[model samples]
Structure formats: C-alpha cells, structure tokens
Target: MSDTTPRIETERLVLRVPRIEDFERYAELLADEEACRFIGGHMPRPAAWRRFLQMPGAWAVQGFAMFSVIEKSSGLWLGQLGPWQPDGWPGTEVGWALHRDAWGKGYAYEGAAAAIDWAFAHLGWTEVIHCIDADNAASQALARRLGSRVLRQSGMPAPYEHVVVDVWGQSREDWQVRRSTRA
Candidate 1:
C-alpha cells in the first residue's frame, strides 16, 4: 500500500488500501457464487487473481480505490469497499462487496460511510454513487440508510455492459446534512 493511503477505522472494522496479503481471503469472497451474485458472480481462481489485483492497480493509477475491509475483533479480511471509478464509469462511486460470513452485519454500511466521507473530504468528489443491481435489495437498503436514492438507471462498462443498475447517490452537501442528522 502507498504511504499516502489512508486507513479508516469504524466501530468494528478497519478499511485500508488493498495489499498483496489480502488476495487469499479476497479470492474466497469472489469465489462464493451467492456472495458475488449481485456483483460479477463467481469466477475461477485465475480470474479471481486478476480481479484481486485490480484494486491495487487502481490505487496506483487513479490515486484512489476500494479498501480491504477487515474485521477488527477477528483481524480477518471481510471484503473490499470504497471509492472506485474506472475508465468510462458513470461517476465516482463508493462500492461494497463483502464475504458471505460478513453478511447480516453492519460492516458494509460502517465501512462505506467512512469511505464516502473520505472521498468527499479528501478526493474533492462532489458526489458519491452506488451502482446497485435492480434486484439487489440489500444494497438498495444500504444506500437508503446512507441517505442516497436512485438518481437514474445505467449500465456498467464492457464485460458488465449488459447488466443494468440503479445509480443511487447524493451530493457532498447532502451527505453532510444526513451525517449531521444522524449525529
């Protein structure tokens, strides 16, 4: 991870830049069909390796990318979530994909909230989006909890172009207002 990479800590999770050591657990998350269904679905080990490397590469090229979500109590890798905007993306986004075991917990929202804060405060991002599949009620709920609503409908880039998603988001000012209300 870069020296400049910021590590964010929530009540029960730690979010840091993706490291090589995270590949094994990260691969496991990608390998689980049900866990990945709303995302890109499951992939073979070799394909998982490539997907694993994308986060670090994105940080190197874009100066920002998803953080590897770690459970603080168990010190285990849970998943990855944070700022992500590759070429031809609809807009700057804060995404989440957790391990099946991490499901039903509040880690996704906890980690993503910190990430969205970082993006708006440090990355100069005016808004943050969550490209959720129409069928992904869980993610939609998470977005709602974060005070986001479907701004529009769009398709992902190549390889996922056929997958239509609801672009849920809110501007930095809106996020701040919500955060304050929560406090």
Candidate 2:
C-alpha cells in the first residue's frame, strides 16, 4: 500500500506486486496441467518455487513485471498478467495466465485490458505483444478481445526458442483510439 508500489483495481480484480503470501496459490497455478498447458507445462512444487519468485524479482529490479491478479471479492490470487520483457524476448509483452477455476469469468480479458493501458501510460511502451502458441485458441481469442492482431510469427529467446509463437499486438496509438471509442 505504499505510495510507490503499483496497484490497480478493476470492477472485481486487483493487480498488485507479488507478495510472499501469494506463493501458495501461485505454486498451485503453475502446477495445474490444463491451466498451464499453453503457457508452460506443469512443474513440481520445488520447481514452482523457483519460477514463483521471478515476478517479485522483476518488479523490484526492472520496476515492472507480470502482476499478481487477485480476486478482490474473495482475496484470492487469480493469476499473473502485465508488463514483461525478458532478455532476448520478442518484444514488450503483456502476458497472462489464470487458474482453471477462474476461467469463463472474463477475468483475463478484464485484467489484460487494464494491464495494456497501464503499460502504455506508465511504462511508456509504444507497443505490447502477447506471444501465443498457434494452437492456444484461448489466448488468441483473448488477444483479439484486447484488439490485438497477429503481427508476426517468431521464435523466443534461449530455452524457449523451440516453442513456436504467434506474436499478437497493437500499438499504443491504437489502444488510445480504442479506449476513446469505448468512452
């Protein structure tokens, strides 16, 4: 709740920095096979622990990273989504992943839209991309819902270079126009 810490509130969600208490549900999400199918395969708790720290580390060092998506009503960690750009990454990416129980709720779309807005305004990003697997219809549809289109087909950086991805995105100018129309 510090003046410096970034926190975003939507109609039913809270996007905030990763806290130690969120690791349990974060581990659960990472270990869910179906929920994580396209993002990355399931991992054991030990491995999940390693991956779980990345978000907080990113926020501290880079001053930005995927946010912990929280269900405001229930105080639950829904998932992670927001600004991300790792070494050798394809582009400035706004990615998301939610637990299976949270599906069909439009939380991803809701959270992602807000994230995109924040990245452009706060992060000063000219463009944002969502690296989606070709078969990942869910993410693809979500990207479309956010008004992103497939800009190119590209391979990721080391470790993930093998995974084929369709980079979907829209420029900040497009986002501003889109937002104006909605208003």
Q: TM-score for every candidate vs. truth?
A: 0.97, 0.97
How does residue 133 of candidate 2 score in lDDT? 94
How many clashing residue pairs appear in each of the predictions shown? 0, 0
RMSD to true structure for each model, in Å: 0.9, 1.1
| C-alpha-based local distance difference test score of model 1 | 0.92
Q: Ten-residue segment with the worst summed lDDT in candidate 1?
A: 1-10
Segments in model 1 whose C-alpha atoms lie over 4 Å from true places? none
The Cα local distance difference test for each model comes to 0.92, 0.92
Candidate 2 overall Cα lDDT vs. reference? 0.92
Q: Summarize candidate 1's per-residue lDDT along 49-87 as a digit string, tens digits.
A: 998989998888878999999999998999999999999
lDDT of 2 by residue, 1-183 (tens): 246889999999999998889899988998899888987789999999999888888888889999999999999988999999988899999999898889989999999999999999999999999999999999999999899999999998877778889999999999899989998
